[model samples]
Target: MSTKLHSAVEVGHLRKVRRLLTADGANLVNAGDGLAEETPLHLAARLGKADIAEILLDSGADPQLRCRCPFVNKFDMNNGRGDALHIAAAFGHASVIEVLLAACEPQAPDADGYFRLLDLTAMYGHVEALNLLLERCPMDVSVRSQALCFALEHAQIECARALISSGVDVTTPRRLYRPDGKGIRPLQFALSPYSDPCDDHILKTEEEALELVKLLVEAGADVNANATIAHRFGRYDGCDEVSILSCAAHYKLLKAANFLLASGADLNAKDEKGWTALHVAVASGNPENVRLFLDAGASHQVTWNICTVLDNDNYKFTKKWTALDVIGMCDTRILDLRVSLDWKKYTLIGDYTEVIELLVEDGADIEAKHETRYVGNTLLHSACSIANLSAPAGFKRSEFENGIICMNTTIQRLLPTVAAFVKAGANPNCLNRFHETPLHVLLSGVMNAIETVSGSYKYHHAYNWVEEEEKPSIQLLFQCICRTVRVLASAGADLN
Candidate 1:
């Protein structure tokens, strides 16, 4: 008989519930449902059926009757087992929440020992429901912290603001309700790029997110809070204690970055890996952010440059690399800057030409050489190597065979980049540790290409005409090579 009443209340059949309650000796108001062991009132509140919930309450339903369900360990399901108020709050049932709170102690936590109604409502982004509960009961310090952390993690702006206004410590590091067991403060979550949960919708625009950040800052949130989460789950290496400014620069949150900068964030703050916001900006290929950092007077100091003296021999000084050296080696093909790989693979290619120009214009050592096992190549050498290895585009074999040499294509594509270095006074004859110049790097790449193509014909004796067919392609390749070599030579390269 109680089972029938439970079913009626679950589907919001108010008349059926009233009928069952009026039956002879039917005591079913607080009877636990077969599944999840939720009482009839729990079912009504969970489904946001205010009429059914009110009827259950009127018929002596225990509003504080806890659900006998296992708690899900995920952030969204952190407090799986709860009472009528918890259920109503989790589902954003404002009317049902008011009914449940009237019959129950509002500040009581749920059965799982994790969430109060405030925490549950904030986690699920139930602003109205949360407001209803807050009006009746005061949130304690611990509960306020938990609610605000959940609110920030889920991007629940209004719920977060309410918690903040109620004096929740924004800088307090609460244990994140994930399997990894790391503690993250509210400000760190706000700075995170992956804060948006799959279930809840909050902070739709950059402007909205920035406003929330301002609110947190105004509420005494730490702008320099360190991120304790590991980066192993993603492409970037997770550091032990990365600052919020580094996170902003890494994720390219321009407005947030500017705001943090304006708020007196430590511009020179280094993470556990010894990276500042400038390193992160350059590494992430965000030239705009890099420019911002530079414009804000971010130090261009690197580890190697710091150790070496300016009065040291030019050759010895060139051995130490800097951010400019890292930019020179950025791979043009890969779009994602956060991918884990060799630091030398962090170049921006042709896309961020303005950034490269900016770095040079702002006094980055244009002729800075990278110390490697094979060579100590400068930025100019790196540029030449990239151009030499890049595949020729839009070249037909017949055009080469017809003696149509398109030097303009080479000039238009890559020569200007080399010219930028030369115009900035790059030493065309500058030798690496192996005594090889930029011309030597270009020649080696060209030779390798020619040798690879020539070896293909060596095994083909029947196709004598194949040599003729190969002539145009080889000529075209050599044409680009010669034009580049000519540009370097004209720029005062050592021919010998």
Candidate 2:
């Protein structure tokens, strides 16, 4: 009898449904079918047969009755059970949803009930259903957050896009927690998604994703809003409490970075750690991203600013860092630049070759004095300091080899930068606060390496090189260093 009633409703046979719902079939109005164990009303709602739905509702259909069908969801957030309203929204049955809401009239769903409908609608990407729910159902900011995040995480771009123009703040994260104990966010995920879209079988094309971002900003998503959650996919580097713009730069999402800057994201807005978007771009070693930030009017001298950091032994000190300083600091790890110097203090390293070129081209403060933590170190001094800080004056076959390659490339670049600085009426021989000149710093490093080579200076690590392979590599490395010093000498450094 129940099977016949459900078939009648599924076929939209009003007369058959009415005939079955007579005194004999009245009890069958809420009977579960053998297939899905869903009541006749659930079938009507799922099929969007409003006429049939109204009959079921008028007879004895329970709008709040749950079906025992297993849900085919990836996350299983909704435990495989749904009511008529849930079934209607999941399939975008706007007309049938109206009937279900009418059936439940005079008793609007409580907060939890309203969101169940909204969540189901959003989860399935039914814009019409979502629109109707957003209209008839009242949602606070928290509800809006949950709805938007659910839409985003499920890759339901249309539903997520529709929710934006409905006055929901796009900057908010979902109230629901993921396995990581962190809530998913719209902008944060757009910048750095936790999983590939294909991992969930939701193919969100790049163009489609960009369109969603456009809708977000068009609806007043804060371009400078600090991310509620920092979802990182690559190397974990830098502080986590980063703004969206900084995160874009860190991930080298050039399109995102470009769009954010075009949308008027604050280029110099400092993150909690006081690193600007450009600072992150420089650290990420993406020359194009670095160029993007600078073209968007990132402060050429912002990296020259000092940030507070702790030193070894827990002493506090202020360090002046620059894009010039952070270049050549990447290896092995992903976008991570803050290398641990034996876990005492933090220093940045990345292969920022083209980034360095862009900075130089942007008229960076080549003669800037506040380039490093040491007092009054000029750009030249800090350039040498980075070489010393990373490689040090060591005499190991491999360490010395890596150190020379790094230092040689850096000073070689700085040599031309020095000429440009001198042409701009800046002094290459400018004295640091220690009264030591840039040339003095370079010479000290060369002397240390030479002394360590002759076994005069204290050095560790045995040279595991065969004599034949050692001599030529060492000679070539010195040639690279010599060529750089020769350029500095020609650039009017006080050779005396």
TM-scores, in order shown?
Answer: 0.63, 0.54
Judge candidate 2 against the unseen true structure and give its global Cα lDDT, from 0 to 1. 0.59
Candidate 2 structure quality by residue, lDDT tens digits, 99-133: 88876631233224443667767767888988887
Highest-scoring model, lDDT: 1
Residue lDDT tens for model 1, 48-111 = 8998888877778877677753223334433367777777777888988777666888778777
Best by TM-score: 1
Look at candidate 2 and give me any clashing residue pairs: 328-350, 329-349, 329-350, 330-349, 330-350
Candidate 2 lDDT trough over 10 residues, lowest sum: 338-347
Each model's total of backbone clashes: 3, 5
**lDDT scores of the candidates, listed in order:** 0.64, 0.59
Give the runs in model 1 whose Cα sits over 4 Å from its true position.
1-7, 22-39, 57-82, 102-115, 177-182, 196-204, 233-239, 302-321, 326-350, 372-375, 379-431, 435-496
